[model samples]
Target chain A: MKNLRLKAARASLDLSQQALADAVGVSRQTINAIEKGDYNPTIRLCVSICKVLGRSLDELFWEDD
Target chain B: MDWLVRISGVVALVCIGVMVYLIVKMSPDGFRKEQYDERQTLERLKAARAGFYAMLIVALIYLIVTSFAPELGNQSRVWMCVMLFFGIGTFCLYAIFSDAFFSLRQKPWLYLLLIGVNLLTQGFNLVNYFADGGTLRDSVGTNYILVLGMILLLLIIGAALVIKMILDRTERD
Candidate 1:
C-alpha cells in the first residue's frame, strides 16, 4: 500500500522526504514510513501533508475502489 | 586508594543524578528531540515491549540456572544486573537507530557522549581492579559486569551510528 500518489506529488514539487518532513514538523523517517505504508498517519497529519504539497486529501491520500 | 574509590563513586552517583534529571525534565517527549513523531513513538513502544519480554526470558533462565547450580547462585546478582543493563541497552539502541531518540537531521551527540563516559568509567574500573591486586576470578563482580555491559552497549551504539551514517550518505547521493 505504498502511497505512490503522495510520492509523485512530493516529487513534482521537488521535495525530498526530509524537506517535506521539515515542512510538516516531523522526521524524515516518519515520512518514509508513510510512503512505505509502514504506518498510517492521523487525519491531522494527512491534512498537514496535503497543505504542504498543495494537494487535497483526496489527491494525496484517497484511493479509488 | 579508598579515597580514590569514594571520590569516583560520588562522581558516578552525581552523573547518574544529572542523567535522571535531564531525562525527567528535558525529555517530556522522550529523548528531548523534535523529530519524535508518532511513528517514532510507536517504534519506541514496540522496542520497549520487545526488550521487556527479552529481559523477562533472560531473568527466568538465570533463575533456573542459579537454582540448578547453587555455586553459580552466588554470582546471580552480577548476572542479573548485566542482563538488565543489556536489556535496557538493546531498547535504547533500537530506539536511537529507529530515529525515535533523535531525528536523523539532528546530530546525536548525547549518545556519543554517553558512550565516551562508559569507556572512561570502564578504564577506571580496569585500573582499580589491577591496583587492588584483583585476579581474573575477582573480576566477576558488579564492577566487571558493569564495564562489560557498557562495552557491549558502546559497541552496539557505535555500529548503529556507523550504519546510520552510511545510510544517510547513500540517501544523499
Candidate 2:
C-alpha cells in the first residue's frame, strides 16, 4: 500500500520530503508517513499536496485494484 | 536541617519551573502553543492514553502494596513519585518512538542540554544527601526519591530520543 505514485511525483518535481512537508505546512515525518502508507491524510491535505505537486488526486493518491 | 531541606526543595522546583518557562518562551511557536500536524497529534493522543493506563496500573500496585503493609503509607510521596515518573516515562518513550514527542519548531538538542543539566543537579543533590548520612526514611525522604526518579526518567527519555534520531538518520524518505 505504499504510495509510490506520490513518491514518484515528489521525485519528479525534485522535492524532498522536507520540502513537500514545508509546502504543505506539515512535519517531514508526516510526509514520510504518507509516502510509506503508514498514515492516511485527509482530503484537504490531499488537495493541498496535489496542488503543490501539480498532480491530480487520482494520479497521486488513487489505489489501483 | 529540615527547614534547609525544604528551602532547597523549593529552590529546585522554582529553578525547574523557570527553565521550562524559558524553553517555551524561546520556542519558535512563541508560547502560542506548540503546533503538531494531524498525524503527530493523533500519535500524541495515543501516547497519552498509554501513559494514563501506565499510571493507573502503577497506582493500583502501590495501593495493594500499601494495604498489605500499612507502615508504607508513610512513604506515600515516594510511591506517588514512582507512579508519576513511570507514566511520564511511558509517554515519553511512546512519543519518541512515534516521532510525536517534539513539535516541528522544537530543538531536540536544547531539550537534551536541559536534561543533562537537570541530571547533573539531581546527581549532586543525591551525593549531598548521602554525604549527610541521610536515609530513605529521613525528613527529606520524598525529595530524595523524587530527585532520583526524575533523574532516571530523564536519562531514559534522553536515551530514547538519541536512539530515535540515530535510527531516523538511517531511514530514507
Candidate 3:
C-alpha cells in the first residue's frame, strides 16, 4: 500500500517530502501520509505528484500483482 | 458591578479585535481568501464534525442540568456561551493536533503568540478580580464563570499547540 515507488522517484530527484509537497501544492504531512500508506491520494493529486517527480503514473502508482 | 461588567466586556472585545487584526496582518495575503490543501481541508471538516457533536453533547447536558435545577435556568446565557467555548476548544484542539489549524499562508507561531497574549490578558483580569475581593458571583448575581471557561479553553488550546509543535519537530520527514 505504501508508495515506495513514488518515494524512490522523489529521492532519485533529491527531493525531500517538503520539496515535493511544495512543488505539488500540498502540505508536507500529506506527502508523508501518501508515502506511509496512511492516505490514498486522489487521482488529481497523484497526477500532480507524478508530474512533479518526472515519472509516469504507471511507474509511480501502479500496484503490479 | 455593572460598570465593572461593562469595562470587562469592552476590554475583552478590544483584545479579540486586536487578535483578528494581527492574524490578518500576518497572513501572506491581507484580507484575501485563505486556502488549504486537500488533506488539510478534509481534516478540518472532520474536526468540525467532532466539534458539532461535542456541542450537541454539551447542550444535552445543559438541558438535563437545567431541568433538574430550575434555579440554573436564570443563567442560561452564561451556560450557552460556555457550551460554545467548549465546542470551539474541541475544534481548535483537533485541528491543531492534526496540523490542519494553520493555513498555507498563515504562520503558526504568530497565531500562537496572539493566543498567548489573549490568555495572559484574561489571566491578569482574573487575578485582579480575585485580588479585589471579588467572588465568582456578585450581589447582582453576575457570575464570572464564563470568563473562567474562556480561560480554560485558551489554556487547553495553547497547551495542545505546544505539544503538537514538539511532535512535529520530532517526527519531521
Candidate 4:
C-alpha cells in the first residue's frame, strides 16, 4: 500500500509513470497499477520507489505482522 | 394515521429491497463502455456515493418521524398519500444528487426505470384519490416542486447518457 502511493505523489509532481518508469526502468503499468494497489513491485521496484520519492527502502516497505 | 405511515414505510422498504437486489445482481464495475477519459469514471463513483448517502438520510428521517408520530397515519387512505410523497422525495434525492455529484460514463438504467415507476405511482394515487369520493387527505396532487424536481432529475440522467455516448464514440478512434 505504501508503494502504491509513491506513483500518485510522483504524478502530482507532474511525472508520468512512463517517465518515472524510464528513469527507474520498469513498465508504465507497473508504476500505474502499483500506484493504484492493483500490483506490487519487486525489491528493485521498492528501491526505485524510494530513490524517486527521495527516501530509503526501510521507510517505504515495512514487514507486516 | 399510523396505518398510512406504516404502508408508506412498507412501500419504501420494498423499493429499497428491489434496489438492493439489483445492486447485487448487477455489478457496479461491469460498465462495458470503453473508458476514453478519466472524468467519466470519477463521475460515476461520485454519483453512486451520493445515491447511497441520500438513501441513508431518507431512512433516518422516516425512522425519526415514525417514532414520533406512530399514530398519525393508520388509514389506508392516509398511508397511500404519505408514501406518494416519500417515494417521490427519495427518487428525486437519488437522481439529482447522483447527477450533480457524478458524471456517469453511463447512467444506470435502473435509475431511469425508477423515475418512470415513481411518476406512475403518483399518477395512480391521483386516480385513486378521485375514485374514493375525493378527500383532501387522500389526494396526492402533482405540485410545481414535484414537476420541477422530476424534470431536473430526468434532465441530469439524459445529460449523463449523452455525454457517455459522445465520449464512447470519440474514444473509438
> Model 4: per-residue lDDT, tens digit, B76-161?
34443344445544444443432332232334456567756766776566567668865343234334334434544555555554
Interface RMSD of each: 2.8, 1.0, 1.0, 12.7
Choose the strongest candidate by DockQ: 2
Q: RMSD to native for every prediction? A: 5.5, 4.9, 5.4, 13.3
Worst 10 residues of 3 chain B by lDDT: B136-145
Instruction: Write one digit per residue (lDDT tens) for candidate 3, span B1-173.
Output: 99999999999999999999999899996787777899899999999999989999989988999899978877766777777887898899889877788887777789889988988887888888888887764233244566778788888988898888888887775
Q: Which pairs in model 4 have colliding backbones? A: B1-B72, B1-B73, B1-B74, B2-B73, B2-B74, B3-B73, B3-B74, B4-B73, B4-B79, B43-B103
Report the TM-score of the second chain of model 3 against its true counterpart.
Answer: 0.75
DockQ category of candidate 4: incorrect
TM-score of chain B of each: 0.66, 0.78, 0.75, 0.33
- When summed lDDT is taken over every stretch of 10 residues in candidate 2 chain A, the lowest stretch is A24-33
In order of appearance, the predictions have TM-scores of 0.76, 0.84, 0.82, 0.28
Ordered by TM-score, highest first, the candidates read 2, 3, 1, 4
- How does model 3 score by TM-score? 0.82
Give the per-residue Cα lDDT of candidate 4 at B64: 71
Alpha-carbon shift of residue B55 in model 3 (angstroms): 0.5
The candidate maximizing TM-score is 2
lDDT of 1 at B43: 87
Docking class of 1: medium
